[model samples]
Target chain A: MTKLMIKEREVVVPGDIIAEGMNYLPSTGTYRQGQHIMASRMGIMRLEGKVVKIIPLAGKYLPRRGDVIIGKIIDVNIMAWRVETNSAYSAMLSVKDGTSSFVRRGADLTRIYAIGDYIITKIINVTSQKLVDLTMRGPGLKKLDGGRIIKVTPTKVPRIIGKEGSMVVMIKSLTNCDIMVGQNGIVWIKGEPKDEILAVETIRKIEDESHVSGLTDKIKNFLESAKR
Target chain B: MAYKKRSDGRKFDELRPIEAKLGVIARADGSAYFKIGNTEAYAAVYGPRDLYPRFLQNPEKGVLRCSYGMMAFAGSGDRVRPGPSRRSTEISTVTQRALSPVIDLDEFPNAVVDVYIQLSQTDAGSRCAGICAASMALADAGIVMKDMVAAVAVGKIDKTMIVDLDYEEEAFEGEVADIPIAIIPSSGEYTLLQMDGRIEKEDLMKALELGKEVCKKIVKIQRETIRENFKRSEK
Candidate 1:
């Protein structure tokens, strides 16, 4: 399995001698000069002098078709819950999509996810207009109330999440905080009095400094120090 | 000596203490919120992407679209809806022009760049502040441009030219002609231009010169804001 490292928004053209065994191009994609180092998945790409090196693009919060994200029920209407996606365009969680269970005629659906209720759901689709669709039927995907919500740079969510579920699992184990990271940049943290505070602070620190390198190390130190 | 007073006790020639915050809106590609005393404005940048069908899109180069809006209550009194009005449209056009000269529009072809400006507070020079905020937002968005665009308003009040006017002072009982301009001080070019009332050609020339001087100061402050933001972003 051959892999190429992409750095600084550029990839090396294959067959070009790159300082004797520095790094080789990935076998999957063809490289052209001046082409943007496409983030195959979402991540941070590192490059050195036109040679690919480190890639940290692997993280969750990947917005996919029909993947549910917990959203704040911002507006209520006769139709559905207008969810603020923490982005420009809000999404709609229709009364019909709320549950397979029956909703009586003109029943106040607000009983389900009222204003400010954070519900977990999936992105049914995203229109070109930037509109988003959401659903609620999934594991651990449900309404959230009485928890503190913090907004961060949506692009940094993957970084905060770390590789696979490792980062979040570490946070959960360290702080013992029940954190649900919404793909839309909203994070809900709930736990014991002191643990919740530590978790929120650590998450906020990650948010403030997410653009830098070696964040995982910093986060690890944070969690470790908090444990002591 | 007939002297008019400002709400903040600033003299007619004086400018308010300027404060700016970039990246206020975390989600927008680039965003900034600024306050010049009581006058505050928020700007957000979106795209160098394909233009929507409803809007006019330039073929050869990217089209820059600016939307300037004032909250009804942004003035001294009364709140208003968030929508486009004639004043906002005019301001948007001038601001867009001010930015055109500095932006490397050719870098983004067959696309549209949208700048949304919302006035949270309003005194006078809202348009000028809007231009400044928009420029900062563009920089925050990481859009490539030749130089920073800075703007300020210069007006002839009581036969004397003053830089940066406030509402109460501008509305003082005298004939005042104000010109708000966006200038690339390094290149000495104007991208945004507007004049209200009338002034002698020489006074206009002088106001233009003063406007440039004021903009140079503003540009320094603007760069500092961008630098501070970069520093914090690094942290």
Candidate 2:
């Protein structure tokens, strides 16, 4: 009989001593290690009693009823243009929701904001059916273009942005880049060609290591190195 | 009349190259997405946690709830309503039933297991496929289950039983008689059963018989897909 040596949720590694006298088969994700320790049934190298997934977190940008989001105009109809939010659902931008200024005759909506243009907007309503309504007349709501876009793990956006944009501002100052972090994980970075590359790489590294402890200091040190 | 045939001239019953990805949604406790040709479905599992309300609580066993929905642009035609409809409600209920048999609900008494299934594309047998995908997602989430469940549709075309049906074939006369089933191949148990048109009892039996064979094939692929997904996730 193999001995029961670990408690529930104990973190085990590829060769962590598992059962010593227990007749149990290791489930998936577990491998016998060096005739002593055994791999865990789940991901993450375990230490005490916590199973670690250690994978990038994933989820659709779920738009809270009243959160701001930056979106892109994908289509335009007579009454409204469809804006793809960084969420599971898209939003409708009504003519009324746009600026009140109007024109004389058959005014082309494209003249106001053509397709492929990004706008910072606020989600006014989200129905149970997943219909989203948007309004553009708000602080920091406007058009954006001319910069390239990159995506990151949606859950990591908050971490990458940090508290009150401090992390982002720091990155901007160090890399000398214009950066916009969208709530949907779509980041728009524009700067000198070399600076842009550095900024993006830094952001990607932040995303990959967000789950680890002491990321802010690591990022600070990275920025210092990049500056030199 | 077969509405549309593949470039290879295979009948509608022929399933496209199938693939599945487990643990696709990181935030969800367990999640998987699968594709049969272009038709895609995503399933996520959450729970064995606290029951939200007393009314929803089960004393002897845990309650299993399944929500099946489709994205607005899931089809090639036009955008659909993103919310729940009558058809979705029915599918959700049937899916719950299909999953309950395979889950050891008694182990998590007073808790609730919620499965959310989203069809990113719509073809025939999506509901059946959706249930199968959800079961795999539940397993990925580390939720305990008796066994994996698999699903597929057996449509009759040209007076012969065909294993998996596509959209256009769904409306054809011969295909209309088809039945979609969800089963646990290991235990030989039925989780779901539905049909629209009339066929002989023998044909129905034959479809079930043939369905079992197809279900086994689906189960093998589902296992392989989950293994591949986990491996990819590590990298």
Candidate 3:
């Protein structure tokens, strides 16, 4: 028998029993102990059918494989480029994975991705040792140019993206701005100065109100009002 | 000696008035300002960011570094130094250990979480107060922890067990024993235990039990403060 110990969207702290029995499964920010499911962090409970997860209200980003992230090149070497992923662990982008072109050995990698240059990349792998491997060969992955990068809590990134990219698409259409969201909470926005500011403000509002219900509708209303 | 009430007119097992507030520092990742009777302390938490000085970085878990300091005017009579003293260093080490167990450092690798505790007023149990406030600050910063740590000092005053000792009570030359204890209320696990002055075996047990009860009450206040802050931010 599966028993839900907490309501949907209720805040819970670590060690709080969120559920009981094996009929339910635990996801991110939660852990399982025997027949009980417990919260592993302080966050709001998210019940998706039989899958229970917790969305943290605050904290730095923890990189995961296959996540599209924005990284700043911190160091360059012959074999790879060390990129700061806004996480505790820095990521590495090998020459072969970074670009399709084949270059000879001893080639200056700085020309490809110099220090302090922000790039939109994907996390190809993250080992148990926390060594992150990044790739920039995918679609929509490249160096961000002439755009302002704003950060929000990484846990709120899903809210900014909305359900199936609805929220981000809505913002882009309303402001005519080209925006890219990194799984690590870095947002790159390229548009008119006024539109850029509006987009940033709207994203921040979404981050702040992510835990509230009817947020998508609220954001839609906000964008409409701003346009007027 | 005849039994007498404390200068503050509190009972033997009574605790000092406690006030705890979270997010007091706007610039810090998480901050708390708290007062226990006349003793006031402020604590701020920063990072889980990359630990610099390369050699200090831990590969498996994040490191928590705490710095405990007393302001020059914090003491009642003589002005104390503003920087870290030998006593402050010892307190900082013990405070760090008290808080380290609760935080799930494995979630953050190669990072350092720095906690800075400043005592603005001294009333004998400031270190305990600092630990309590620093734990609140860590939770407010949204660091994942198994539980919050709460601490209190229990002492024998004129053969009476008192929960919190003020400056005068602490400095009394009478036969007394001051034992400061920090515990995770939910688990009843002691993270810190220190004793000053002599204590008999039976009296030590009594003091531990009383300290645990008082710490439980303090933990309740800590949780309430964090919850209230979260509620306010929701709006």
Candidate 4:
């Protein structure tokens, strides 16, 4: 007989037994061990049908194709610019894909995206070597200016953004801060100095309380109180 | 048996009170503090970031490096010279090997995961404590692992086999055998096995059995610390 040893959404660390017997299937952050399905990392366990997956609550960001990530420009050569995407591997934004407008050969790329500058880019390719290729031609993809960037845990990003971006919209509407949250866990905020600080604080709070149920209402209350 | 009563008054199969905490160092990617008896160890994990000295990079997967150190005043007697000593290097190598089998770093090609374990105090079993702390630190960093590793030094003093040997027991004026070992809880496999002195084969097997039992208790404490850390962060 198959048995589930852990309740759904239960927190589990590596090697924790989630289920026993062959009725269950293992998914992300989980693996099969003989007759048991075990957690392979620290995370919240979720059950979907017969599949068991552990959603990681911690760890560094891993880049994926089609993810619109915010990255810091770290290097510039004649052909491409190297962007640090808050991960172990950096991405390349070549001259041809850097901008919609034609960039002539031997052009001064520093004028476009210099080192120490932050930009929102879309991942175009991720090769087997973990090498990444990025593009800045998409709508809303460009260099960010004057706004301070803060990082949250990448895995908690969905909660910060909320369903259809309701959570971030709430923070912006209340704090009057223009905020853009990147999938890579980088958040850029620009507004009145006080509003920017409030926005950053509120986002960090969400990251911390992401595991708590009914968090949206709690955040709403938090914003309402912070306004006074 | 000349060794009738333990100097510390602990039973032969007893371990000292242990305390464990995670994310103790704010600057580190993952950090843990583990103390057993009077010996305390702090381990910090960094990187999976870029691996420098290009030649050292492993294109297939990330490299795991462990460095074990002790402060000059960490031990009794003369002030120990600071920096990497022969004994520290040997312990560091073994520590890395003990932890590598459990972690999967295939996703981080050409990167490196560095674990630094520093002991601020000592009784005995410093290396084992360091290994335990390092294991937790790696997991706290979100490194996927097959299982958590727990360690304890089990040995024989005179004719008595003991679970955890303190400094006094180590320096006991008798035929003593000190075996420091690390165990993977779920699989019940030994990742670390080193011994000093000598014991009869029968007694050695009994000592290992005792150590595995003590390690399960240590693993319970380590896992609880991680769970508690998340609970505190939720608020």
Best by DockQ: 4
- Per-residue accuracy of model 3 over B70-134 as CA lDDT, tens digit each: 98899987999877778999999999998888888886777899999999998889999999999
For model 4, the TM-score of its B chain against the native B chain is 0.98
Ordered by lDDT, highest first, the candidates read 4, 3, 2, 1
DockQ of each: 0.06, 0.02, 0.49, 0.78
DockQ of 3: 0.49
Every candidate's lDDT: 0.70, 0.71, 0.88, 0.91
Estimate, for each residue in A1-228, the C-alpha lDDT of model 3 and write its tens digit.
889988888877666679999988899878887788887677889999899998887777888999999999999987999999887779999999998988789998888889999999999999876889999988999998987999888878999998899999999999999999999999999999999999999998998788888888998899899999
| Candidate 3 TM-score over all chains jointly | 0.92
Estimate, for each residue in B1-235, the C-alpha lDDT of model 4 and write its tens digit. 4999998888889899999999899888789999999999999998778888999899998899999999889998678788888999999999998999889998889888999999999999999999989988988888888789999999998888898899999998879999999999999999999999999999999998999999999999998899888878776
Q: List the residue pairs that clash in candidate 4.
A: none
Q: For residues B92-152, what per-residue lDDT tens digits would candidate 2 score against the true structure? A: 9989988888676554556677899999888777887798788778766655455678888
- Residue pairs that clash (backbone atoms under 3 angstroms), model 2: A1-A21, A2-A21, A2-A22, A3-A20, A3-A21, A3-A22, A11-A46, A12-A46, A16-A37, A17-A37
Ranking 1 against 3 by TM-score, winner: 3
Instruction: State which candidate has the highest TM-score.
Output: 4
TM-score of chain A of 3: 0.91
| Chain A of candidate 2 compared with the true chain A, TM-score | 0.73
Query: A1-228, model 2: which lDDT tens digit per residue?
Result: 455455543332222345543354454444333333353222333333232222224333556677777789999877677898765456799888866687435577888777888887788897654568988888877777666678776668877888888789989989888888877678888899899989999999887666556777889999898778
